[model samples]
Target chain A: MKLHEYQSKNIFSKYGIPIPKGRVATTAQEAKQIAEELGGRVVVKSQVLVGGRGKAGGVKLAKDAAEAEQLATQILSMEIKGLPVRKVLVDEASAIDQEIYFAITDDRASKKPVLIASAAGGVDIEEVAAKTPEKIIKAYIDPLLGLREYQARDVAVAIDLPRDYWKDFTKIAMGLWEVYKNTDASLAEINPLVITKDKKLIALDGKMMIDDNALFRQPDLAEMRDTDEDAPAEIEARKYGLSFIKLDGDIGCMVNGAGLAMTSMDVIKLFGGEPANFLDVGGGADSKKVAAAMRIILTDQNVKAVLFNIFGGITRCDEVARGILVAMDEVKPSVPMVVRLVGTNAEEGRKLLENANMITAETLADAAKKSVEAAKKGK
Target chain B: MSILVDKNTRLIVQGITGNEGLFHTTQMAAYGTNVVGGVTPGKGGEWVLDGKIPVFDSVKSAKDATDANATIIFVPARFAPDAMFEAADAGIPLIICITEGVVIHDMMRVRNYLDQKKVRLIGPNCPGLLTPGEAKVGIIPGDIAIPGNVGVVSRSGTLTYEVLYAMKNLGMGASTCVGIGGDPVNGTNFIDVLEMFEHDPKTEKVNMIGEIGGNEEEKAADFIAAKMTKPVASFIAGQTAPPGKRMGHAGAIIEGGAGTAADKIKALEAAGVKVAKHPEEIPTLL
Candidate 1:
């Protein structure tokens, strides 16, 4: 659940955070029109959901409307980090006196939302934290108390900001926190919170990633998801209540739990086979969901072999076997298949699949080794 | 001698009238857990599962009736946090939440309340722990566990089962196995379980299963080096996981170079723990 920069800025504006006026443009003419209205000088940014767009040449500064249109034309037709530039933000460029980095993310160790701010801005903050270390300051906001005035001041002072801008910095920080809390955002960041020549602060770039588990209450935020930003198989997998991530290799992994699915992938690699994709049917997955999962995995042409490694606790092996039987009839996949069934009703499930032309393994290690050999043979 | 639940763990199932609640409750009782009763709000005064278990309206009433010291949740996400808070208030010392998708914000509040009350919460998204042949709680299969001295702690559901199966394959049975859940924030962590295993008399060796996400594994490595005297073997998943893309679990992601499997492996190995390159290597390493 990642939001594009323009989308993030839209949410930021609602919280009273200052942002440069910008409009999303699908075509170069729209970008030029927005640039002309903003007095010609503007930054054309690709609205992809990945970082390093500037390094990938998806971000460009134009001196005037003519250059804005040319840059937009170049950016709109290009791809950055495998994401196409379907839309670009034409934003008014401002003169910056200084830049600062600011963000709010969940700290797993503390189990609280932490505010990370630094005086050094407009670059990779992780790099800064790794290199300088002391320049970056993190403040954990108490959930009940929230970002207190003193806590906000700690970040500002730690960044070595002038006393005159402390109050304004606190206001922006609070606003950012509001956006994060209200949107159910896992992460909310504003890189290069710039100080203009006149001493007014504005967020030059914005990013927000909403927690998927909290989407039930945040319907409005959920609607902002761009399916175009996701792979088609991934989108299809979600509809069936299955979690899927496409990978490069020959073996397709289908497991029940998230941890098991990752282990299935890792074991494949360890056994000298690369995983084509990661798929978790999730607990309580029924026959229909299992069929849907197989259908989605079969659509991956890179997958030459399919492995079913299930530890059926909440997810019964019998139900999974039934689903595979149903899928085998529908998909009729030509690739080799290997399965290792264990736990509840595994004997019945294995009985159901015994007639199918699939190799069965006694252990996960055997399953991985067999799947690798079968996949390589198929290749 | 188990780390958490054992032969004495009397259990209450929250949302007991629901489908998952009834299923696992029946299984837990069959596995010899003293599943006393259950709570399903309006379904009080009724009997479920062929009238073998009593049903109460709230955790307090259930506790009063069953003398239940522990409770496991099977409620939906919307009511999970409230069920947890109610169980804590009802004086249940051990709370095992099997309900996945509990809101992160709700967890924060529940965690704070649990800290004040000195309660042990495990897995809002986890498979509850098992103490081999003695007691079973949550959803881990009872048949695979064999009574032995190995202690296992994991952040994953299926991977824990895989590791336990591996140990069982090599004639190494477990004392107890705990899945702390795969969410970014959980009720318990690796260090907590490791510390418990360090002191447990029945446990001889320890197995840790970690994946991508926060630096918890790295921190746990430091804890093992500083406090733990028992031999520890570890395995980390998601070495091929792409950076910035979450691999299924909310917490399993390679972000900011902190949660990479390589970094965690390097840290854990530096702490004198035998790090398994694969699951099959774990039993040998230990």
Candidate 2:
């Protein structure tokens, strides 16, 4: 999950990495208070979990407390890239001498955690990578052995960093690695790790993305999840252990596995129908879980028709059929539903749903065609 | 006749006392997989499945007693890494992990550890291997396949079943089906299974099922173009999925304009492999 800039900086501070003195402000008045505490010269950054905040005018410099409040008011009322700026970070402005780009993320090709660093900073790393490939340096770290001091020093030297700053660079690198490892972060970034006029290094901007699968152990990090960034139906679906992504269309897709769920969506569009959402009830879902998925799908008003595609392996079609029946009794949904049950106990499942006032098909192609027609008729 | 599991395969179940373990163990045994002993900590000397299969306290004891050549793990994600380590240490040549949601870091460590050993790990989140009508290791339904010359390798479970069901309707079956899993950092990849299928003489043709994530499919296409002489068909899912939104699977995300269905299809077609536009079309292409 993506953490806001302020939250990431807080984690960085906890790891002994230096960050500008700041706090998150939810309103203009709070911004003035934080700016005054930081001695009036500050940078107000939007707390949205997206990029190009500067291009969207969500970031501004304030010369004093009054200007800080004025800019905060402007940013608070602004919406960048369709996401409203609900909070801003007011940080003490510092004198910068140089900048560096640094991050640690899993390199899928190597199947290991890699530390990426460059002398170029405060810009799009992808752009730099495309422009000057030699500027980008990477070091792969074994998960068992972890990042070593020599490796960090080599990165520092590769960036042509002066010897005097090697110790501070190594410390920050080690601290960032700890933050990444301890928080189970898929990515930990420090863009523009600036060296101040006094020669102290401080993280000017930070971002951390935690692994969703590791959240069970990192409870503290999990609790920092920003609920406002997620849809309510999505949060509800998570509670039921179902993976659902709402989309803009009329056909609601419910399938047994992730790959099949996506394939079902593709087939719907191939048959000239747009899917309203992608929902997977998982490999071993029971009747209750299936009912929950049905409710979640019906919650979207755009769904004029629902498609139930089950190719049961660990999941039995009979149980999924029973789940649809249970949900039908509770929700009393009016939209048409096309059910295609295959695999284990498929015959029993088909028999149970024969008289349930739903359309039935034998193959995915047939199901898609029927659902598209049903959705068009419903429209 | 199969690449991984076959009639000669003697299998043991880890976490056999758990609900999923006991259930799939019964299914595998019913499919004619030689039922060796099981491993459940503190359940040593106990017997499950109506006193037919013995339960040992550890993989070592079970391996020593049954001389099991292969083992399937149903342990939860938290302890799954340790389970793989134990199986590797016990010298099991083939280890198939059916557990899902294992942390990527843990799997990275497990992958590194298994690299030095003479073991093949299938998945940390996958639906095991199936050698139609002969033996089954993991949770691929025993009834969906029949003995044939086609070798299937997929990154999905139910989608694989969808393709295989269509192939079966068209009078085609599998030599063996392998689910390399959906996690970003799994032990096995498309190339590993593709290489195996390319070498198996009993398998004449291959069908690859990939989704919209990673460059594994593109890499496999290159492997097919450069090395394999057998005919290969391909299907790439999630053409309609939006970028940046994970489509159910952890690895099924299109980020930064890469790992898209369009890219995978282009790569496969450029390699002379018939790319199926739909899941049901795989059999026709093959």
Candidate 3:
């Protein structure tokens, strides 16, 4: 749900927060045109989901149109941490008087949205909080009232901004809060909010992460998603309403709940095998969804064996049993599988799998041992 | 004696007409829970589950008519807060929320409002607490649990079952098992349950299950170090989960160099609690 910097800046601009004039360019020619329109000293930043773009050579500054185009071409061809740079944002470079940090994110300890502002910016805030600690000021916003005017002013003063700049800082802070609340953003960050040489404040950098659950209401923001950044299995999983994360292992796990899915992987390792992936089919999934999930797992060639560990609370064992049978009919893969169905109608479900000649275990520990041994024999 | 609920827990279910509410209501009643009434707003003055339970339009009406002492919420995420608010307004002392995916902002508001009352909110995403062979609220399976002297508290659903199953395998049983849930903000926490178990005379030992999340386990370690005299066992999950990523649960994430399994284990171990490497090892440690 993380947005690229350029996308985040666009949302920020809509809220009246000033951002440097910029346009994204996907090619070298487009870069030159954008730099020409902006004129004089443009920063070409590669748009990738990963962090540390500057150290990874995904960001560079150009003095002229030709250099901008050259740098954009270099960045477009580069890959930062295995993610290819598909687009470059050509933006007007700002001459900063000073830099400051501001962000709003969820704080579990307080169970509220906490604003973290620091006079020290343009670096990792965690490092600063761990070291100086006093340079940063935190304010918790009440969900009922939201970020109050007085709270905003307190942050401005704590960051040590001059009186003359307090009004602008407050305005930007209020705007950031609006953008975050409206977009269903889990995080909204403006690192290096710069005061320009002309005594005007601008957001030099922007980062946002939208909440996944809120995406249904935010259609415009949902369309901004880039599936290219996700693993193939993860993408397929969304279509089937399954939660799957690929890992480096041979035992393919399909469990009912999130915690159980994780525990299934851990048990596989404890039984002397590595987990190929983590997949949760969720509660009340029917045959079709299970078939789709099985096909997706079969697509991963690393999976030598599969395991189904279902603990049906809201989910019923009979429904899951039908899912496994339907999945076997559709996939027809050569790999072996160990099935363990516990809770509600488990006896009937176990009967169904046993009749299909599939290996069944009575306990999770036994299922793990069986799956690991079955995978080794398959190899 | 068991904590939270026993024969005295008169239960009213919110969102009683909903699929989850109806299903768990029947399950809880079958396990001997005292199902007094139900609430479904528009479906008030009706009967559900073949007229075994009476339905009311609001928590206030239900509370007035039945004097229900506790309520479990199964409403959708959007209406969950309102449901909790109604229960709180009705002066219900114990509220167990089973609804998941509620926005953190909503919980913050609900928490702020509930702070004024003496209500105990268990979870907005948790599988409710269970007192085996006596009363079962929430979705924890009733068959695997047996009434015994051990106390269990966890932040997960399936992992809680796994822990209880392991104990059952060793001829041990539980007095009560509570899933505080994996939400970032919840009403009851590890400390709350630990405090309850420490005071309950029938409970001899306790098992605490945590994952990579907020510092609940670490804070619980401090509480155990200072006040706990009873034996405590601990098991931390997600040992191989990647850092700084949400691992399925809204609360199960590592952030800012905290909430790692290793950190939780070290904290609990330093507090003189036996920490299990896996769920199977929990019973042995206890």
Candidate 2 lDDT, tens digit per residue, B20-96? 89988998898999979899999999999999999999999999999999999999989999999999999998999
Candidate 1 chain B minimal-lDDT segment of 10 residues: B103-112
- Candidate 1: TM-score of chain A is 0.96
For each candidate, what TM-score against the reference? Answer: 0.97, 0.99, 0.97
Q: Against the true structure, candidate 2 has what lDDT?
A: 0.92
Q: Is model 1 an incorrect, acceptable, medium or high docking prediction?
A: medium
Docking quality tier of candidate 2? Answer: high
Checking candidate 3 for backbone clashes, the offending pairs are: none
Stretches of candidate 2 off by over 4 Å are none
Q: Candidate 3: which stretches are off by over 4 Å?
A: none
Candidate No. with top DockQ: 2
Q: Write the per-residue lDDT of candidate 1 for residues B1-286, one digit (tens) a residue.
A: 8988999988999988898898888889998988899999999999987998999999999999889989999999889999999999999999999988877767776887888899999988999989998889989988876889889999988788888877887898998999899987788999999999999999998999999888889999999999999999999888777787777788887777778999999999999998887876887888
lDDT string for model 3 (B203-257, tens) is 9999999988789999999999999999999888888776776667878878877
lDDT per residue for candidate 3 within A237-311, as digits (tens), equals 987778888888998888877777888888888879999988878756677777788888889999999998988
Q: DockQ for all models, in order?
A: 0.71, 0.82, 0.61
Query: RMSD in Å for candidate 3, one decimal?
Result: 1.5
Model 1 per-residue lDDT tens digits across residues A56-160: 999999999999999999999998877788999999999999999999987777888899999888867778888999888899987656778788888898999
Give the DockQ of candidate 1.
0.71
What TM-score number comes out for model 1? 0.97
* Cα error, candidate 1, residue B118 (Å): 2.0
What tens digits encode model 2's per-residue C-alpha lDDT throughout A1-379? 8999999999999999999999999999999999999999999999999888988899999999999999999999999888999999999998999989999998888888999999988867779988998999999998889999999999999999999999999999999999988988889999989999999999999999998989999898889999887899999999988999999999998999999999999999998999999999998888999999999999999999999999977788899999999999999999999999988778999999988999999999999999999999999
